[model samples]
Target: MEGICFLPTFLVIWSSSTFIVSYLIALFEHDVDVIFPYISEIGAKPPESCIFGLMTIITAFAGMATIYARYKFVEKLNEKAGVPPALNQAAFWIGMLSCLGICFVATFQETTIIQMHDAGAILFFVSGVLYTTLQSIISYKAYPYGCSLALCHTRTGMATIAFLAVSPTIICVLLHRTEDKDYVFHLVSAVSEWIVAFSFIFFFTYIHDFKRFTLKLRTEFVS
Candidate 1:
């Protein structure tokens, strides 16, 4: 159980470190603006791009593990509470799709494949927001079993903020595209992207619940 808790904790730490390290390298190389550069921009060029792509790939795997563990955890609780599994199942699939988006973003560099990179970003944000929203509802539904009211509220708030932030991010990105070097729109989009991304990561703070559950595997051989 304790070991399972580390999954989400590691996801948070590794993802944040990936962004920070890539950002610093890009900054020192004068590859990005000092203020509010798009998260993808820092990873668009040479050495930093390599690190970003590799680390983000690992982060995507970590995210998948954390999300799957969470899905199982909620499923168990819902089963015990005699609640239907539809919502939990939906959330699990949506979360997996969001992680797939992360892989897409990591593989497609913005400079080399701008269309793919943008598509990946949009997929990640939209799926992530939906995932969190569904999980928040699941948390409330599972409250009587193991989830706390406070945790439910926290998840709800973070999901709402991520949802709100994504709208401005998309709007500003589109607006920036129409203009010539509009730093203001770019800055707004960058800031909003950070907020949404971190909010998605932070929602994994529910890792505390993982302490009550264990993940195990069994192998069987068939003749």
Candidate 2:
């Protein structure tokens, strides 16, 4: 929605709160010691299933908010320095595609459409990696200009993204062994998923400075 850009902080709160609550709901549904069970089993149940679906939908809106803010943030940076327009636009639209992927995954549950869900999941994570990597580069460059993020922020953000980006490979490598060995793969995948999830959280920490970005808009003369 056009209004999504108007309330960036609201989007952050909505997305963060919804995800935290939904995860809590799912976490309580099963055992706590193992990550595999949490990754694979928790969301398929009654209340958690509903919560998961709602969280997915909220995430879509949150993604929209992210796109709205991210490019605008870069647009301002571009004015201070030279940032590739293509890179900024690419980051925004690709991020949007990730949001669409989240919606697709939510609509088609793994039980009903595993292939589609997996595709969506892949889209979300892959696009997220590209979007973050591109913006991180831009931010690092813009640091000399006026970007408020500290060096540590950039370093941590990149590290978290790396942790997340490496996870799919782990899943692919370890997912197909025999039952005895498969749990190891599942555990790795589960850990990677958590890394990715937290990476997202870590990335959004940049929101603290978004208020410095002046919202750009166009209006027609009403004469």
Candidate 3:
């Protein structure tokens, strides 16, 4: 019951907060003229880059929400199963470091590259990988928590669904009007989306089984 209650709350907060923050950053940080390179087009002088950025940002935040909610619920479950707070804290910190490493690499690339949008997609893909890896760590660490298994599974499920659902939509929309189907740019985008989609799947399955294994333990104990 607690898991159910906390999961939705964490999801709502994390999703809303991250999306708002990322949207504002995209609006100011990205310049549309670079990608579109047109002077007289729809909504002249408006930030077209922000639209795509918003889409990506929203997608990312949704995933984060799922991860956060799952982590918290799992933490509670671990507590019930005699897991120590120190262990959870250690695992969480390690996950944070992993996530930071990916973000830092992406930041370095963004700074060095001039035409960063395409490369940025690679970074986003990396980010998704790190995100999943961290969630997997959390799920694995909380194995003693019985009810937490469900939340852990939910987290992976949501992340996988979100990425697979969002990436193709984003790619198809961006590439739809583009005539350069054979261009290297299109190829890179396709590859990046594929990487992101599969990473999410890997993380989902990994975390789901981790949770289920823990739940199985709990069930045995109760029986």
Candidate 4:
């Protein structure tokens, strides 16, 4: 896990930057309404399409790597302290499912396969929330497991993240309340999507333990 922060940090910055740029491009190239246009609308056209596709590949790999690194790190620490696996294999497999959803969403544009795209989006969000929450819990309990104080210092932030992560569910209620106002529902949905994204990014920041790992070249032969 040495230098493990690099890829996750890159993935966050890359995904955020590309999505923002692509969303801007989509606004100019498509008939996208500013407030209500879903983030997926960005992938409906232009340089946006290419950006989304690239973002997807980068994110998929990075997300999987992040999961693996965190799980293995936690597993090792837990083993050392004689604590059973905190999140365990279930969390890892669930994370992989989330990765699949992310890849699916990126590879197929919502404009092309609306149902499939929506399904993927749903899976990604739900699984991501679950995964992050589980990791947060595991980290909270991982005292003396060599998790840095900074990494485990998510007390106040964890509450904020929990509140933010409920954005989509709250939007669901709002969506039903504003049944007749399509624009309002759409606008709310867009906001909720961004909320989820930001919350997830912040949650990953809590996994600062990877800073302890470092990479080095091994000159050993691959016999």
Candidate of highest lDDT: 1
lDDT of 1 by residue, 65-182 (tens): 8889988888778766644588888888888888889998999999898898999899899999999999888877777786778888888999999999999998999899899859
Clashing pairs in 4: 2-213, 2-214
Q: Candidates 1 and 4: which is better by TM-score?
A: 1
Q: What TM-score does prediction 3 earn? A: 0.38
TM-score per candidate, chains pooled: 0.96, 0.79, 0.38, 0.81
lDDT of 2 by residue, 166-196 (tens): 5663464346444455656666666666556
RMSD to the native, candidate 2? 4.1
Find the 10 residues in a row with the least total lDDT in model 4.
154-163
Encode model 3's per-residue lDDT on 74-173: one tens digit a residue.
Answer: 5657645555666555544544443443333333333244244334444455455545545545554556454356666666665565455446534653
Model 2 residue 178 distance off true place after TM-score fit, in angstroms: 7.3
Tell me how far candidate 3 lies from the true structure as C-alpha RMSD in angstroms.
11.4
lDDT of 4 by residue, 1-223 (tens): 3466776777677768767777788887764767646667788765788888887778888888777776776776775654346355667777888889888888888778977877788788777777776665666667657565566566336535645655664466357445875665666567777776666674357346677665345697787
**Which model, 1 or 4, shows the larger lDDT?**
1
lDDT of 1: 0.87
Please list the residue runs of candidate 4 whose C-alpha ends up more than 4 Å from where it truly belongs after superposition.
146-181, 203-207, 214-223
TM-score of 1: 0.96
Better of 2 and 3 by lDDT: 2
Query: What RMSD does each model have against the real structure?
Result: 1.3, 4.1, 11.4, 3.7
